[model samples]
Target: MITSEKIKIYAHYYGDSDMWARRAKSSEKAILSNDWYLIGSLIQEIELVNKGLASEKFTLNLKKHLIESCDNQETIRQLESLLAMNK
Candidate 1:
């Protein structure tokens, strides 16, 4: 599943409210129990979902890292440009 497809799935699953409620309930139980096993599994599932989504238009694993890096680089560039103008 591409990112867009996963996003659509997420939207549908969340938008309906029923499925979302169930998911929320299960997650809450897991949290309350302090179940690291469940938590770890949930994290892996979310990561898989994200990976599927990002892979469609992005390079999968590096999507978030790249976005963060790009944002950082852009900020630095803008700061340097501003400083140059001030000088």
Candidate 2:
């Protein structure tokens, strides 16, 4: 999917829990529940319905997606910085 479409999907999932979504949006680190797995193995790895662990690989994949779909410049900069370190 294109980044824009993925962003919409992300927003839709987050929008389900209105209050929790607002809080998650405001927080730097948020563990959200959604069946939005970009990495297939994550499905097997996670015991919870939609919760994913913050493994190095998972984190990298997420950041890459956000960098593609996120509009926030600061957030992209932060993600890229972190990505550089991982590489």
Q: What local distance difference test score does each model get?
A: 0.36, 0.39
Q: Model 2 scores what on Cα lDDT? A: 0.39
Which 10-residue span in candidate 1 carries the lowest summed lDDT?
Answer: 78-87
Q: Number of backbone collisions per candidate, in order?
A: 2, 0
- Those runs of model 2 whose alpha carbons end farther than 4 Å from true positions after fitting are 1-14, 17-52, 74-87
RMSD of each: 16.7, 11.4
lDDT of 1 by residue, 1-87 (tens): 112222233333433335554665564433333322322233343355545653543444344433343335443233223222212
Stretches > 4 Å off in candidate 1? 1-34, 53-87
- lDDT for model 1 comes to 0.36
- The estimated TM-scores of all candidates read 0.23, 0.28
Query: What lDDT is reached at residue 33 by model 1?
Result: 34
* Residue-level lDDT for 57 in candidate 1: 39
- State in Å the error of residue 60, model 2: 0.8
